[model samples]
Target chain A: MTALSSPATPWKPSVLRLGLHRAALEIKLFNRDVLSLVLVLFFPILMLSLFGTVFGDEPVFGADPSGQGGITPAHYYLPGMLALSTILSGFQNLSSYVATERFNGTVKRLAGTPLPAASYFLGKTGQTLYLIVAQTALLLLAARFLFNVPMPDEPGQWALVAGLMVLSTAAWATVAIAFTALPKSAQSASTLAVLPVLLLSFTSGVYFPFSQLPDWLQSVTNFFPLRWTAGAFRSVFLPPQFAAAEPGGSYGVGTAFVVLAVWVVAGAVLARLAFKWPPQK
Target chain B: MRTPAPGSAADAITVRDLRKTYRLPKGGTLAAVDGLDLAIGAGETYALLGPNGAGKSTTIEILEGHRRADSGDIRVLGTPPWKAAPAFRARIGIVLQEATDSGELRVSEALGSLARCFPAPRPVAEVIAAVGLDGKESVRISTLSGGQRRRLDVALGIIGNPEVLFLDEPTTGFDPAARRQFWELIRSLGEGGTTIVLTTHYLDEAEQLADRIGVINQGRLIAEGTPADIGGPELRIPRVRWRDAAGHHEETTASPAALIRDISDGGRREPLDLAVVRPSLEDIYLQLIDSNRQEPALTGARP
Candidate 1:
């Protein structure tokens, strides 16, 4: 009876410490759901494999008619896959996972616990980064071995890719967290979340080159963060001259940074406002 | 036992004029809890028995800090839950109607991760054992049956070594065996002097476990007392029934024998299919909720 001290004046653990524990739990749970794995990992890798095989070794854009001294379609589409994978991991996977949790009463149970809300969210943040980084690495490896997509020559190009990865993860993860509140049930989470990402990936040029789209469609893509994401990624993967072939005749890298950062801030605010537990009534 | 008024000493939870009103979709408001008052003393196992949508869950959720009351003076562990500190949450454990959403983690994994968040949690092994989840510790939550998941839910709730525990419809989908097993687990916890407040529509469950029962209907406490004496003397009166040439008839009375004699006309004639029976707790509960339906709906609720 006397082994442990009584909880007379209840003490709280540090949020940072608990948050790490939560993150660990989150990572373990990541692979447990088949749907989650498909949403974040398989969909993009499969897309890359299919696209690279379909357009193998063919110099599509920024290539000479002789198909020499220019980028292959595989190389061009590889970066788009990376950008698309990052958002899929960050947004689509996150929304569906949390929506299921809410519908199943996991969120409600956690809210009743002593765990700080910040710690719960911190765990989600950790899960998003882990998924994005893991999915990107795997997608890139598949592209190289499967299609022989070449890497950028400069180390600085790789660093830029990493930075954009961070921005995109933050922007889309927060938006997905907010989006969970919009779905009335877990069944709708997949459709509601994936539809927008699928649409934007088209408008943002993940499905094909931005220059191939209609003029009106090109202008419409300007309003989305993915537009910047796909462009920034292309700037790194393709030769610098290809930047001139972009919508603005340049990579628009600075604007890419700005758009993604804006989404990061706005998404954070909306997530705070819209987060809900199960049994909405 | 008599409950001291709200704000009295040693009360684990107290509510004065608590009200929660929700806006109806078309036009109007439903006062889920309207001017309800409650007081539960420390170490008491109080069962709030109510039908669905009676505001029992609503009241408990408000007490659990998951929702805010539209208007009320409420306190759990001497602090209003909405404004309470982290310590407030630490001192209280909650079992929701549905358990955790994900079935991804093993039993040990889910309990261990949550246990780390508390300053002094019950050992994961101990919680699992307490909830009768010993051999299943390594099993994934999804693989466990519904009853096992509920035991895990209780394990999560009590892992914090909470001073007070709130169980909201904790045994809703359980089989007879599982329900009885859950009652044993709860009874053991109550014996350890933990303050337990549970909500269930099952009257027999209240009779088996609760030290006191409060019957809530239409968001108000219709009756509060020991299970044997609940619904007051009037609701507990015995009934006599018989069939005559005219038709089947039933009569309620404190003295069923006298009523039976009158119906049989002093033994000169027998009332066909005559029977006298004492009302069970279930009867009292049904009558209680039914009586509430006949009452006026308007509570002068403010917009």
Candidate 2:
């Protein structure tokens, strides 16, 4: 047999370099998916505009008894929309991407390569982080211009929103990985992911006021991360008067931070235990 | 059967006493790979042939480092694959039974991305041309035909310039033309001294591509040899068929020439419809598998 003339070998790539390459490829492929891109970038803003245009500025019975200073529904719903955008990108988008790759055998093919386990995960997480950041900026910009929603007036409030965005993205992204680990196929994972996202968003105040729900229901919502995330956003986006309508007549800043932190830890652990490369048999 | 020693550094691949069992979802366990041994020399194209439920895939998976074996000794290119490192993986390429579908990625993009996973990779353009996908390089994977996708899978497998390439039923969905084209590509790769390990149920594919063939059945290594001597030379009898005034007659003989001479001596100058029937690789393969089924594995022994 003749000798195979090998090309000059490059230096062994580090795990970080491998991960960055994978992330770049992931983002390129994701950009080509028009439906998912539209959902991630514009769906929340569109919903915000629709609701703002339709719902009147009239004060509700308990939210504001004095009708003179009542806020419009646009301002009231902006915080919830922001939370929804985070969930859309972090949980729904990430999980579906993973599940589809698994079902199509992309994950198995990659597993057979020299790529490390850490690189595969870090690459996916990096893709989600980039998307969430872009999503946050786009949502906030649309809110400010399209609906006249104000930016955070205080640096402390800005700090609060940024902190919450990071925590929520990391937590939900981890939760999504765990979700992919449970489904037997990509179709099931995509269909099943919607259930928890919808359930969490509805009960956690992304679609309605958490305080207005039955007391028992509010108590149930308290255990989840989305309620705390939405409440944290409302603390920064809504005016001080809106605090009266919140569960404790305040932002619950201490509880929100603690709850999100616990979820981050719990989600990371669950992902560690559940996530399988190439997926389970 | 002739069994090879485990972990022979000289050969590209060596296996011995390889065994793996899977727990049934409903009840008892099932052994997927029983005690089996095999060896393929460096720079040789060795085909592993078997039926659907045979242990061919399980054996390949164990060798590919994708699945763990309950107990076995396997050495591929001087390393035990189960505990192999990144460098070990870089030297090998695998095309699984199911072709990976990265639908949104273009053909070049898919191969280019995978190439980055290896330390020394062939240029993406060269691999694309090698697999005859130059015209479809910019097309998205989803738009490619099944045969085109399979060609791309082969492109990705070779882009790393691996020393050993494992192809599991690589041409399962290819049309006749595509299958022949694939065979040419594989033959070219073998010429370059890459050790090719191919698993397929297609006997003709084995005859055309393999220098040596191993037929695995029911988790056991039942037959192993070159394509011409697969079932052993002793059992391979050429059949003599002839038509006389009365009726047609058939007989299996060690020498067809001797039979023809004897028939001629009986006063018929030429026997009508006389022909020597030589069994093709497919016939031998079917006979070997069929015979094994008649006497199933021992009751206590696992398949």
Candidate 3:
């Protein structure tokens, strides 16, 4: 009989499926976290506008200087902004978030429960994906409409953008989980998480342009994801001629993809090894 | 709610020679839990009472699988929690001693989600009501008062209808009314034959809720017994006091009655202030904790 019973039956967890239960809870919590909600959802769009119009209508550095292909300042900053958004949401935000959870005993509570260990991570993955999707969509809309920053016209270009965003998000989020062990405590999490992102932004052509930075700086930043995250997106957003401005004379999209994929794997392995759930004695 | 507490013959939990030690900063080692042994009858309500760092929380966490004991044999429902399968976890519940809550989820949302993890969970509304959070169901956890959040913690713990529940300082932030209600809930759960393991600072709570109480101090079980008997008959000895011409006098003895008769000369020499005082559980617990304080050298329990 399909009749609704007064008291609930033994919870048929078999029907809920693994990770989904945890994902739902995680999403609900994030939905109401005003600080993180605003930062991830609107911060990118805000950044897009705040910096989008800075060098208005000018032929940005390393783009097609002749103006034959109108790669304006917005075009230059758009990819960097996307990369910055990825770093903010995936790496910095997640590192401090996990640290706070560990320090405050959220992980301890989950650890003691019957909940599958994977569900907690799956929940984190779910939260990160939600943030990444929202941030990317918001930034794209703001760039496209608010700043009139033209998006990639071709489906192939958009597909590649989607691909890079996914890889970067996965890599950064996993690495954030692994990175939680670095700080002495939660109070230092934000400081430590933001330091690298800020430094990488300035040195890795995020706040600046990849082609404009000294060759040595470009070579050094290549080891990190921000340089490639920005480069990968710039290839899609800017015209083919802008590839000339790259250090490798191309976005090195192939290497960028490989590096991010490696980071995803490495981050996962390291996180598995380094993840601290129980409150440190 | 469950099969008459699963036959009182089997212990719901047992720990033998449990030990957990941590290296202190700048050198030296601290034995958080050392050579501790414990057992709880299948349907018993047991409270582990101690001071802030007396290792009561550590012991409970080890049982809950939140921390691993360095060396020992521990069984909760016939399985070691650290190596226990999901089925084993499903049988137990834990309320960790923490201030953290599901950040912004409504009380109902968090409870509802956690309830889905168990095989036989109490209804969401029922658990909420039991914890005195009926009206606050839709309220965000981040906004709940400290007492309310603690109630939510208790709610999440029992939502699963666990056969064995571990509550670490379960009523830490509860107001007097809330604490009383929480005690009633625990009593009802105990009456249902559910085995409960609790760690708390309040001796009255232990007396009110626990069928048996253990006083842990300096990483060892210093004393264990029922509310009336813990700390041994020696510690429970009554003190007879009187004010007379000489001065105020207090004498502790096994037989306060005979002592009173001898001192008062069969009521002829008795003063208005003559009285017999029996030490309460709280008094015994404090004496045990104070006398059993661990030295920096990491010595064992005081002789």
Candidate 4:
């Protein structure tokens, strides 16, 4: 590695430099965590096998009122599983990593250095992006090759879904980081973030379709980012006219996109305000 | 005093009336660092001597820009540390109390990555050699012994070739030999024009390395001077011990010379065992802390 000599022109420490350095360190450190490796890769594969087999034959929303199955249950569930994979990569992975780093005093060590909080979070964000992209690709490949799921027909729709996945995950990662900052301990953080996400996954129609759920439960699920993300993802693969054939009505692709985007922005803002690079006394 | 050329021997750290306090969860406040003043010149090795909870770490953390002071004027390499300018940080190195556990990463790989953060970091091999870990570069950090891990901590601290270094209990867990070796490493770094601020519970370590020592108690500096001057050698009266002619053990001191002379005047045939003992640095430190504890308000008053 080449070392830069002390510049004759003194360089003022910029927030950007700290952020970049932090991101680099976070990436390096996260890659070394054994739990992170298992969660990002192994956990998703395990979840896919469990859900794919149990709910395999049943039409996801069960035969439409027209007395015909609109799409294979595997096809609809694959996208939701992929979204779930992305969510885990972002929210679960980031929250736990932050909490653990805080507990271990690694975050305190870094704070003492020249690196600023912004640089650290930026580095963390970079790492999360890298992990999420890799996990998403693997999930997509499995869906395509192993499950024999068809790819989205239109290139535009595919782009939209990809954008949504990246944005929604990035947003969730920020929220997770903020949550990690709030929780006092790693155990608390895991319980607070993991339990809620698991609960949401069940209710938001990731493992099973939303149409089969009771009215009040469906109403609560609609408020969650997972529901919209899954809805947006399904819109990309399912027939455009399929929305008009639904019981309550067609899921609005545009509305789902907007909600996910808003959550992402809100999460980023909250993370900026609440995220503590190092725990306070 | 002549100002040293740029980046040469000069004042590397200047802190004035630095203060930091922690607000308790309930309603009270804990003052960790009360108005403290210190200035460390370039290439000088200074030790901040204090007992546990004496605010040594808090002071060091403020200097390192890790914790913001409640109020004070401070400048490290000509910039406020809490501002934490890259230029300021580039010139200073810090070895934290605990080492980061970047698991499964070999020593070489870990140092190599940290080196990238600095604009001008030393060669990884050189750093390893300096810390006396040349042969174990390939070994994972998890597998290293306690002493070796501490050495690695120092290695990472100095990899950036910092003009000033902050070491917080750098040799706490080391055996005597390892501690001595670590002391020698610190001496060499000081010799090479690196301003060093060290905090340790070991009085011997401070006496062995510090050109100037400052004693802090209850968040205030009680004394700041060279080892000899802070507690005057004259004030350390020698104790005279001897076996009198009657074969009775006797120890007396107002002046050891006078006491020895009196014992010799009443001497018998047998040669008397006589010795004069002056106070060690440990004795002086104890006296200082004892006096400080007795009068809390006077603890901050400079001697």
Candidate 5:
């Protein structure tokens, strides 16, 4: 008969060790999935290229001729593509991974371990950040080399945009985590998560200016995170005078940042309350 | 940090009135594990023997700290498993029935990642060798065969040098040869002083691996003991077959040896295709299950 043996030493596990271990697993899985890599990197680039060619030489959203004439189609599409990349990093990636892991009992297996829930999320965030950075680099290179788009003159504006991008992606990733927790299966998660992103991208002006949309559509689109993200990105890249070209001139960067922050906190709370480590029952 | 002195012999695992119930999506509660009490002693390899929907898996899950119980006073290694403290988890390992879909990660890579969770995990190469995946360490998980994947599952379960290992239907889909190999692996682990808790529907598996066996039916433990003790020695009726003078076969006996002696009439003649057969573990299990089914409300009956 085996006796109940106590630990010979006090048990103390580092959260950093747990996070790093999970991150390594996540990165390995992401790299091995060739299809997912291609979609994340090139999907936005393809969308931008198609829209730029189709809408060439047109007066987009009725901006002043002086400011509008100087901007190329690529320049107009670049910010939207960046916003698209952020959405993919958060909603598409997080939801699918969570759903698949849950379906296959990987999460159940992990729940038996000593690792904490926070460490798992930290690892997922690390993977999301890596994908977003890769997507950003690919979009920028394609914009500069293939379309001859002008680079931002002020490095400070670029820094601010980069910071906001990280914040927004983290916020959206939280929302994805919360949403995925409610799904019963991987199939449901993929459909539920991907459809909303696709719909929002279309209505929130990823392919065309929001001003082209009618009043009712604009009001509905404004309630979503995609519109604010696109508007914020545009504010950083476009000149001050070009604000007249956009629906809500100047982008309301402050309000956009605040709303995204609120979503992040709310999403985190929801995830904590509802997320199942190995699922219930 | 010094190890605590070994406590009472009754302290391996102690449960008093353990119960678990869950709410169904359509709105009623399902009692996965009803009020149950069980205890395993030190150095014991105990098997929870039952068929599907017998609540064996639910009981094991609660003990493994993966699920919470609705009502119970349970102590595993002197701590409530569902509390899920790092200290409590460190001494236990679990091998779930399903293989993890880790995708494209090499066998060694997955084990290496899991090793970080423990304070003193076994060497990665040693664990790989123990599970019989020695030369296939570099092979990705996606390419492994079903049996090989199951071996990998065992490898991960023991990498932490856990004192107690829970194996939930470990050989569900294994071939005969693979099952034998797994049995040998389990034997060696048990010989090394690790207490093992296994669940299986295979009667032969329980007979072979368990020092003590427990059979759960519905949401309760119906019978428990060493295999021999489970079906009493006197209850092991043998089959006796012999031809009569008129060429009609006859067979009846509690002791076939005695019956054969009486049939021979104290003098040797020609053998008549006679045979003596002892009751097997499967026969005993079926008899117990049948009796349990016959009396549905029999409470507190222990084999």
Candidate 6:
């Protein structure tokens, strides 16, 4: 008979260590999936560069003709682009990847392992963080060099941007995990993620200034995290005079932070309640 | 780390009154497993044979800790598998029916990464060689053939050095030569003292590898015994045949030797074209399943 033999040496595993190993593999796979990488990392940059060139030299119709045009449409569009990229990294990409893993029995195999479910969750979310950081860096560098958008000059502004990036990514990633339960297959999951994110982007000022939209429509975006993400980025990146383009015309930095914090707390709770480790049949 | 002392429990697996039911789309529930009982000794190979929707996979999944039973007690490796304790998982392995769908990883990379999950994993190179994928170690999983992917799944299952291995239809995609090779691998694993619980439709596979066979139908264990005894004492029945001037003649009897002698009783030294035949395992298995399905007593016994 085969006895239940233990290992000769004792080794204890923590969530962090196990998650790091899983995250390492996940990051490697992400690096190999050229299509996913291009979508998450380069799609936003490509769109920003294309649109930046188209609008950089043209003057906005509403701005004073004699004011030396303090900010071009490209400068106005950079914050929104960053916000869209964050959504793509955290929500769209993550939901599709998770759904595929579940559909293909990868999630089932992992669940059978000795690793904790928390480790798997943390590992995938960590990969999301890595992607978002890379996407943000590439986008910012592109905007600075290709469009001559100024870098955040103050230390406090840099801190705010860093904080916003972390909070928004974490919040959207949690919601993405929760939303994955709704899709029955990987293909449907990808399509599901795209439609809502695209719609949210249009309404959340990802392609245009929020103040330019109607009053009722502006009030509608107040409920979504994407709007706050865009607002937060604009507060950090755009010139102070550009505050007139945002709702309330003062760059409500405090509201941006508070609304995002609410999303983080609420999203974490919802995801915890809705997420299923093995998925349903 | 704690080691289980030798001979603490002779049985590696024990189950009592297991039951599971799934709700159908039309709001009625179908019982997938009902009142099933099984006990397999340590170091013994048990093959669970059943037809489709016969609850074979559900029973194995319950034992593998991948699914929960509606009501039952199942002890594997001295603990209820449903607890899913990591310590318990480290001592058990499973090869699921579907091949693992890891497309992007190379063979070596997949093994290396999964090895970290266990406290003491077998060497990656050794496991690769064991499953006959030595030269294909660098090949991407997407590029592997169906048979090769199944081998990788087996490799992952054994890499943890588990005592109890549960294989759910592990040879579905294997070609003839590959199937024979896999049987050799399984025999070696059993010889090394792993308690194997297997589910397959191949009766020959069961006859070749299992110490005992359990045939289930409609959530009930219809028959259980050694391969020879599972078909009942009628297994000894043999058909005696011969060709004569009149025609060919055949007769089934429990004593084929006596019947043959009687046929040559007229002082004839030999009988022309004489032969005796015994029923194969496949024939007996089909009869058992067919008889069980025809029994009206087995219906409406869901729980």
Per-residue CA lDDT of candidate 4, range A1-281, in tens?
12366546665456676567666666676677777778665566667666567667455443568867555556667767777876787898888877777876667766655555666677778888878777778777876777667787778977887787787787688778777777777678777778767988887767776677788988887776888777777677666665653336666667777877787888888877776544455
Each candidate structure's TM-score, on Cα atoms with residue i matched to residue i, is 0.90, 0.94, 0.90, 0.89, 0.92, 0.93
The CA lDDT at B18 in model 3 is 97
Residues B62-124, candidate 4: write the lDDT tens digits.
Answer: 888877789998888878887565667777888988875554678998787667657788999
Colliding pairs, model 1: none
Candidate 6 — which residues are off by over 4 angstroms?
A1-12, A58-62, A278-280, B1-8, B242-250, B265-273, B298-303
User: Which prediction has the highest TM-score against the true structure?
Assistant: 2
B239 Cα displacement, candidate 3 (Å) = 2.1
RMSD of each: 4.6, 4.4, 5.1, 4.4, 4.1, 4.3
lDDT of 4 at B73: 86
lDDT of model 1, residue A90? 84
Residue ranges of candidate 3 with Cα displaced over 4 Å? A1-16, A58-68, A277-280, B1-9, B287-303
Roughly what TM-score does model 4 have, to 2 decimal places? 0.89
If ranked by DockQ, best first, what sequence of candidates would result?
5, 6, 2, 1, 3, 4
TM-score of chain A of each: 0.90, 0.90, 0.88, 0.83, 0.89, 0.91
Candidate 4 has an lDDT of 0.77
DockQ of 5: 0.65
The regions of model 2 sitting more than 4 angstroms off are A1-12, A56-63, A278-280, B1-8, B266-268, B297-303
Instruction: List model 6 lDDT by residue over B1-303, tens digit each.
Output: 111332346889888889999999999999999888888888888999989999999999999888888998888977888846787888888898995467999999988887888888889999998889989999999999998899899998988888999999989977989988888888888988999999999998999888888888888888777787786776547889998887899898998888877888844657789999888888888877787779758542321
Backbone clash pairs for candidate 5 read: A1-B42, A1-B43, A2-B42, A2-B43
lDDT of 2 by residue, A181-236 (tens): 77887789888988888898889988788887899988888888889889888888
A146 Cα displacement, candidate 3 (Å): 3.7
Determine which window of 10 residues in candidate 6 chain A has minimal summed lDDT. A1-10
lDDT of each: 0.83, 0.82, 0.80, 0.77, 0.81, 0.83
